[model samples]
Target: MNPGRPATGGSTTTAVLGALAGAVLLVMVLVVAFPDWFAPYPPERTDLRAVLEGPSAAHPLGTDQLGRDVLSRLVDGARLSVLIAAAATAVGVLGGALIGLLSAAAGTRVDSLLMRAVDVLLAFPELLLALLVVAVLGSGAVNTALAIGIAAIPNYARLVRGQALVVLRSDYVEAARMLGVAPARYLVRHVLPNVSGPVVVLASIGTGTALITASGLSLFGLGPRPPQADWGAMVADGKDFLQLAWWVSVTPGAAIVLVVVVMTLVGRGLQMRVLR
Candidate 1:
């Protein structure tokens, strides 16, 4: 290959993954935004006569134990997955940013106190922290979101704090300080905007993490109640029937894996682009 020519293999792989991720995310968004448009039957509608039936023309993904259309339930489940992920990501990002900014802006005593608390929280694995919170709040979609969001906060808080410290030490910050700029105005206008890029990247990655945590919680019976179509719950529902009907559990599990992998790839791509 000519020295001037860009390597084809690595870039080609990244491009392919990006395209795949984008296509998956687009489908997910379409399903979540308009589930009724994609679903052939009401997700809750049951046909007991057809229970555990294999895939056929009428039901492309087959039927669950209750004879509910697996395809329709999967489409409906997309709504819950996307909603919880979005909500939890927003909560984690916004709350973490505020805490991080506060830690950086405050005096040494306050900064020390806040960072120590964050460190303590970070000591635990994200799932364990989420499970602890869910145990206290009780199981439900809202609680699941809150639990995952709270678990996610420490990561963002530490990330933002590090960025904030760097921005605070920059020459423009020094210049602003010299010019007698008010502390509040200086931090808000100069500090935050500069540090926000990294925070955005972190939030993008954290969204996938939040989704996984939420789904795991649901699988463990800590999310929305039964009969509601949830991907995690669907997988749980089919666990015992895996030997007889694999599609019921496998389809939803595959969806979760696809979503998480795509999100991570996209987030990594965005991070690389941002860094460049």
Candidate 2:
């Protein structure tokens, strides 16, 4: 085989995977945007007589302990979950990018100082950091999202700084600098554009993590509160009847797993495509 054959094969694989991921993501978006359309029953509607019923044509995923349609709840949960995740990711992306740009544009000493601070933030586990932030800020979906995004900032900062450093050192960038290009102009036109691809790919993966973290917060009763169809809360509520009605918890858990897996595939595909 030719020496370059492996790279070509890898590229082909990434292309196929990316296409598949895109398709799945499209479906997920549709579900999230118009959950009522996909959900057969109102997510919060309850039937005392149908409580904890197993799967049937009327309720494919079964009824929860409260007789709420498991499938409908899961579908409804996606709307809130994805919105939180996307918002958190956006916060991380914007905040981290700005920090990274400041570090990259500044001199080496400033970069070192900024990065060390970022490193300190990264030292804590993201979930723990988010918890602390949430504790200080108090509960609710917006607060939870803000907390998650704050914790995620260090990761994005590191990624963007690394990518920016490389772009800054490129021959063209150096030539532009020497040719009297304004710092702001080059940083915007060249560095920002170059770092964006990696930032976007990281955001794709980060959204999945953010989603899980948001769910976890909700599980702890820190997000969205009761009566809302939250995946994590669904799992929490179902745990009491786990022995008798396992489907209650399992259905939402499975949805979380599937979504996380799909996002991961999409992110990985984006990474490979960017590297190529």
Candidate 3:
């Protein structure tokens, strides 16, 4: 019944979401910065005495079929997952943004041709495209990251092109052109900056998707090989023992969910702040 209560409620929700996102980020950082400290046992080490054990003081999240520590593997997996996501997102954003700029600057014929190409890429399902690339390139962390980056480029290209076109028509760009600014200078100094805001937000959101995709590829035996401890790979390895040791699968799965959820929340907040 309070007249001003809606604003209060919205602020509270944002604050809570922000806290959740911060905690997730901190956990990821810890996993990367102090992996050995967080993981009591080596991720690849097998402990025959504790094979397939449930959660216990000696192994907080239990042991896997190979008797490797579940918690250790999950912690190590975070580092690999985040690394691949960041690398793929960077490649997509940089390559796509540049292509989008070129297409926009070159006018109707170029724009149409580039957009059509984007459409072709977009026509295929993202996962399918990634799988195709992995199949061709062969599976490994680097190849998986490259494939995800390539799969994501068309989306960023389209987004940046649309934004660049809008900016191209703006008064600043026209004034720069009239003042005889070089095309490269105009784009770098004026057009690119304005369009980059949305590109950045999109890139942040894309990170979570990239991580999920890379992990999925790895799970399917098309990503990093054994002992690397990627989250998807962990889940894939534990599937056969699901009934015997749920912790092996559940721990890594939960970690993936938690990280992706927090990233999504952060991306939404950034979009609201920047794109609004």
Candidate 4:
């Protein structure tokens, strides 16, 4: 057995999940990087005669109520979804990590105060919190990103703080403190690196959550305005035509589900690897 490989029993399962996730990730990346090249028709172009058509040679995935190519929209939707998720996760990870580091380093009234504030924020359900933020900030891609990012911060902050506290007790951390290392240097050089693995895993998982949240917001008419080709907006537009053009809503919904499921599996795999 290869020393680096997992045991045979669970390895097959992991491999299958990993393969599925890798395929989804590849499709998502390709769509975002070259949407026009992959799309069969312009996402915004409409053909009234083609509206509600089922899958065919001309339109593999069929056409929506607006006669826009379903496949093209789906592909472009991947780009939007992935971009929003990545941006929100990046914001959450950086903001949360900084807040966590500060909370741990302060170690007194400041720590208590910050954690209490986080607790207050965490008291609301994530979706509710996101809704509140979006309502306050008004809807758009930027606001959606910010709302999702803020909603995710408490989770990352708590995880980072726990990890940082444990790292602070380690021998190396003690040595650094005894050597009179500046608090900033100690956190940057020691605490942050040691606590980063779990944070990374959490951020990956949070990306899936962010994507789902953004989609939900869009579907509810609180995201980017129409004609922008967002997956949620696509689903919303297809709702009225469900009897005739189910593919519009169904396809985008499936895309969202597939992306989130794959991301979750990948995140779990990373966590398992980290634990090992």
Candidate 5:
């Protein structure tokens, strides 16, 4: 009958998920940062004798069609995915925040103009927009990241702009304005700091999305070309051998799903905590 008693089922489930997600992410970071430490063989190195072999003591995850170790490639692909996703997300966040803040600060005329442009961009889904960009820019890791980042800009810009508008109207902001605070100082000191929380949460969630998008592009041959490892490219590579070597593609696909789920869970948790 104690009101302070912790809820059992939901709390337990959440705690378990949090722990699992954290563990997976830690392993991912470690593998990405120092792949040689975790991988028994170089990702690209091949052993013709082990070609398309099933899991065993020597190669727990087995070998790919090229006789390359699946486990090692997965780790390498993860590093590539994470690096591209992080870079793209940084671009999206930085550019989006700047545009959004500018729109919020520049009065109704500028706001309307900027928002209309955003609306035009938002007419297309992020994936479609990114594909369009990739088509024009040609395919590679850096180009894919840039395309994804550009596609992501509208979402962040709109979200930040809305929040910034609200913050700009608050009594504190009005008071600062009346006290002759310069526009730059007022925005830097007040507007951005206030609106950054939601932007951060969105950025965290969007990184996973960007990763998935990048993978999708790689699958379509618009991302990092082989024999460079990439999750999507790995899946694409194994597609022809799906029946014979399920682990080749399936493992990387599972990794992608797991990472996205973890990021979503963590981002949701952060959102709830920050909003509260």
Candidate 6:
């Protein structure tokens, strides 16, 4: 019945969502780092006897065209999917933050040049920009991650610059300026801390986008090579077999969707709490 009570309830829900995301993230880390622990079968182990089988007690998610266990491949794929996403997010945020911070702190001429560059990048769709990078670098897991990261940089840079500008205009920052504080010192000690909340929230959201982009690249044969399990690769492998046996593609595709959905949910939760 009370406005404060509804706000409190929303906070409680956000807290619960955050907790759930943490648990899921932990499990994913373990699965990615040591896939054998959770995977019932070796991702590469093949059995002609079980080729293209549907869900069964022995093979919960079923077997692929080559008889590789779907669940095992999904587990193994966590490394490429989740790790690449995390790495891309880190690269994008760090690179963008550096540029953004400098652009905001630097005088008008430098800021104009830097932001103009960022504007050019922002003109391209994120996926298209990633594709362009991949085309130049050639396909591979590392390259895919880097490409996605690069594609993500402009967005973060713009966000960070806007946030930093707001902080720079704050009363405390003006007071520091009046007190003869050095620009560099105050920019770091004051502006960065104040602007980081939104960046963190954006990074979480960006990770989900990176994950999907990585998978899409992999689907194009730009990801890990054969026998290397990655959600995108798994989906790629199963595409031809969909008419014959849907599980080969469906299982890994489901994993990609599930992980991305969870990441997005966590990001939204963080945004609610951190930016509140």
- Choose the strongest candidate by TM-score: 3
| Model 6: per-residue Cα lDDT over 125-160, one tens digit each | 888999999899988778888899999999999999
Clashing pairs in 5: none
lDDT of 4 by residue, 138-217 (tens): 99888888988999899989989999999999999999989999989999999999899999888878888898899999
The CA root-mean-square deviation of candidate 5, after full C-alpha superposition on the true structure, stands at 1.7
Residue 209 alpha-carbon offset, candidate 5, angstroms: 0.6
Per-residue accuracy of model 5 over 13-98 as CA lDDT, tens digit each: 87788788788888888988998888888898988988999999999998998899999999888889999999999989988999
Model 4 stretches astray by more than 4 angstroms: 1-7
The C-alpha lDDT values of all candidates are 0.89, 0.89, 0.88, 0.88, 0.91, 0.87
**TM-score computed on alpha carbons, candidate 4:** 0.95
Q: Is candidate 1 or candidate 2 better by TM-score?
A: 1
State TM-scores per candidate: 0.95, 0.92, 0.96, 0.95, 0.95, 0.91
- Residue 4 CA displacement from its true place in model 6, Å: 9.6
How far residue 57's Cα lies from its native spot in candidate 2, in Å, is 1.2
lDDT of 3 by residue, 137-242 (tens): 9888898888899999999999999999999999989999999999999999999999888888888789989988987898798888776889999989889989
Q: What is the lDDT of residue 239 in candidate 2?
A: 86
> Which scores higher on TM-score, 3 or 5?
3
> Stretches of candidate 5 above 4 Å error?
1-8
- Shift of residue 78 alpha carbon in model 5, Å: 1.1
TM-score of 2: 0.92
Q: Report how far residue 204 has shifted in candidate 5, in Å.
A: 1.6
Clashing pairs in 2: none
lDDT pick, better of 3 and 5: 5
Clashes of each: 0, 0, 0, 0, 0, 0
